[model samples]
Target: MKMKGLFLAGLLWMAATGMQARGMEHFIDELASQQEVTRVSLGTAAMALGSMFTDTYGVKHIDVLCLEHCSDEVRTKFGQAIADLHDPDFEPLVSHSENGERTKIFVKIKDEMIREMVICHVDDEVAVVRLKGKIKPSDIEQVIQDHGSDR
Candidate 1:
């Protein structure tokens, strides 16, 4: 009798977890349908195929979602789901608003290097991008060092 109860409880827990993931599936499906998208370290084709065969490790787990005419309801739901899914250890790297636009960056790091970063911006449109895998502060500094003079 006790074993049956425990099995039922475990099944219920698994169902709940699946439902939570389904909430985020809407956004994942939408972002995946975009034509001109990049997967950072991985080529676009590998990223697409990776989605089918295995986990994101081979592709570094990077994902970008750009929506042009997104509704407030969808955006709000996505934000809520993101909050639910994001790591508790993530720290705010940047938070700024100017005029009617806002940009926020949050990151999870260890040993002074970023393990994952989430970049979200809402202005003329909405874009939420997540970058995973090895990303150090030096990678960012290099971008500034290389292109700071261009702009």
Candidate 2:
């Protein structure tokens, strides 16, 4: 009888865990759908995607898709700094929007990088899919200029 109870508990736990995982996935999708993702770093494990939103505190705001935890201040500063270079919002970061079923923009930050993903552009359904490509802190504009439309 004890064994039966333990087995049932384990099954219930597993089911609960699975449900939680699915819920998180849904949340991710929902969160990604509503944002102006600027730069995304696919390589670095740090915060790779930065969502730009200037809160009342003048703090930079970013939502990275990497595997790391960043304080609100750090996110704010980075977002603000990045924004300053381009209309203080990085809207032009959506450069070279080649019409594809999907599209991505690579954002470079200082130490680590993050990716900003956009999904289903063809269908007018933009979603923060994931890190689009490698990111770092460098002259992204210069690199693009020098590299000639590769990055």
Candidate 3:
């Protein structure tokens, strides 16, 4: 009886892991085919592990890609890809475009708390970032404040 229980538990764990891997691979595969991609950075699992010690939250998967000479049409498609990943029930927090450049930020909330954030930017370069966990409004405020100070 003990061996049977162990075998069933192991099988369940393996199946769950496989499904998680497939979901992660789907996005990576989708982005791999795009051309003019100059640089790519992937830190999904790595960042999750590091987040435990940093007192940071709401960052799950991180992928950044820079593309040069990207056309307007391609940029639109990139934005759509990120938009499609968002939860349709709640509207994104920020969606703005100017001078041929675009930026969109999405957030998911549960129990009146921010749970996830996805940010995308396109223009001379394209970047897509996905963060999963908990986030607060003040975090956003501080980031924007610090960014303005840098300039």
Global lDDT of each candidate: 0.65, 0.38, 0.65
For candidate 1, the C-alpha RMSD (Å) to the true structure equals: 7.8
The alpha-carbon lDDT assigned to residue 83 of candidate 1 equals 44
Candidate 1 structure, TM-score to reference: 0.54
lDDT (10s digit) by residue, model 3, range 108-144: 6777667666567766667766566667777777778
TM-score of 2: 0.24
TM-scores, each model vs. reference:
0.54, 0.24, 0.56
CA-only RMSD, every prediction: 7.8, 17.5, 9.0
Per residue, candidate 2 scores C-alpha lDDT tens digits across 17-42 of 77656532443454344344343433
Q: Which of 1 and 2 is ahead in lDDT?
A: 1
Instruction: Give the per-residue Cα lDDT of candidate 1 at 142.
Output: 72
Q: Which candidate number has the best TM-score?
A: 3
| Stretches of model 2 off by over 4 angstroms after superposition | 26-151
Deviation from native of the Cα of residue 98 in model 3, angstroms: 1.3
Off by more than 4 A, model 1 = 1-59, 76-87, 149-151
Better of 2 and 3 by lDDT: 3
- TM-score-better candidate, 1 vs 2: 1
